[model samples]
Target: MNHVLENPVYSALRTGDSHLAFGTERIKYFNEEVSPYVGFAHDDANGFADLYELLPEGRRVLYAKPIPAVIPQGWQLQHEIKGLQFVYEGSKNIEGDFSNIVSLADEHVDEMIELVKLTKPGPFGKRTIDFGYYHGIFDKGKLVAMTGQRLHAENYTELSAVCTHPDHLGKGYASALMQHQLQIILNHGQHPFLHVRDDNDRAIAVYERLGFKVSRPMNFYFMKRL
Candidate 1:
């Protein structure tokens, strides 16, 4: 049997994040405004076919797995991202100076979307803040660095959208923001995990220092219904 984290999107949609899920029992997806992720209860050709029919033409969706899958007919492959999954290994609770950290809310969506657009920290959407626990740092009232929670499978929660504006690169904002998020997830009695591009050595090193270990190799497939 595969670990729940192996297919986190499905596990999350069925569990902790169920309230935000859409689609059938066998296949689940987040609202397009929240996330582009879609997951299947189990990998099957019929599942893919169902997804192809469920979504309209040219609708793009992201699927992740421990390994790549063969794209069946009626779907167009757009991009394939090779990444690594990291699970938190430390037991100590992280303490950070969060005086400047502010909890993000619905009113912050426009700035959040703009920051995501500039930083390209993955497929963040207008409703992505709905995942809750999004926090950010502002400089002169301008949003600069931020991070948030994404997939939640059982006791495992994913740390996502970690990014710092280009102008604020060397101020240790990313680390501070990440530590803030880590503290929150840890305090909630959930294990925090994350996925990062395999080649991001700097980020991998930072995550390792923060007590996250590489759990497995992962891949993200972006495809569109035809």
Candidate 2:
């Protein structure tokens, strides 16, 4: 049997995050309001078909895994994004002050969405904040930078939505938020991992500097209506 680590998103949908999933157990997805990511139990053709039916007619969605060349019907490939999955390999002793890093809640949802829109950090929705602990930095009462958890599989959690407002760049706000989230995941005894586009050399460097090693190459399939 393949380990859950190899297919964290799919595993997460079927396991730790089933409550957030839609569709049948064999092929589930996160609700449109939460994320545009989906998962299947396997590479079975019918399972893919089930997803095509589950998603709205024109909404684009994302899938990252070792998918075969044969494409499923009703879903056209938008593009293939090359990325690298990084796993933190250093000690969990990394420290940072969480004083101003507030827990993003319902009241902060609108602010979070606005920040995500400005920063363009993957597929964040109104409810993406529900996945796991999301920490943010506020400057003069404005949300400027944030990072948080996305996928969960057994003892592993995928760190995602790491972004900072363009105005806040060079201030290391993103780094601070990331360390805060990473430490939280570590404190809970779960391993921290993240995916970054291959072209994001700067972010990759930041992750590497923080002790995350490239564990594998990844292809993120962005799909849409045929």
Residue 55, model 2, lDDT? 67
Which portions of model 2 miss their true places by more than 4 Å?
67-70
lDDT of 1 by residue, 1-226 (tens): 2399888988999999999999998888998889999988655659888888789898889989898788879989999999999998885668778899999999999999999999887999889998989999999999999999999898898999999999999899998999999899988999899999999888898899888999998899998888
Please count the clashing residue pairs in each candidate, in the order shown. 0, 0
Per-candidate TM-score against the hidden true structure: 0.96, 0.92
Name the 10 consecutive residues with the lowest summed lDDT in model 2. Answer: 63-72
Local distance difference test scores for all models:
0.90, 0.82
The true-structure Cα RMSD of candidate 2 reads: 2.0
Q: Please identify model 1 stretches exceeding 4 Å from their true place.
A: none
- Clash number for candidate 2: 0
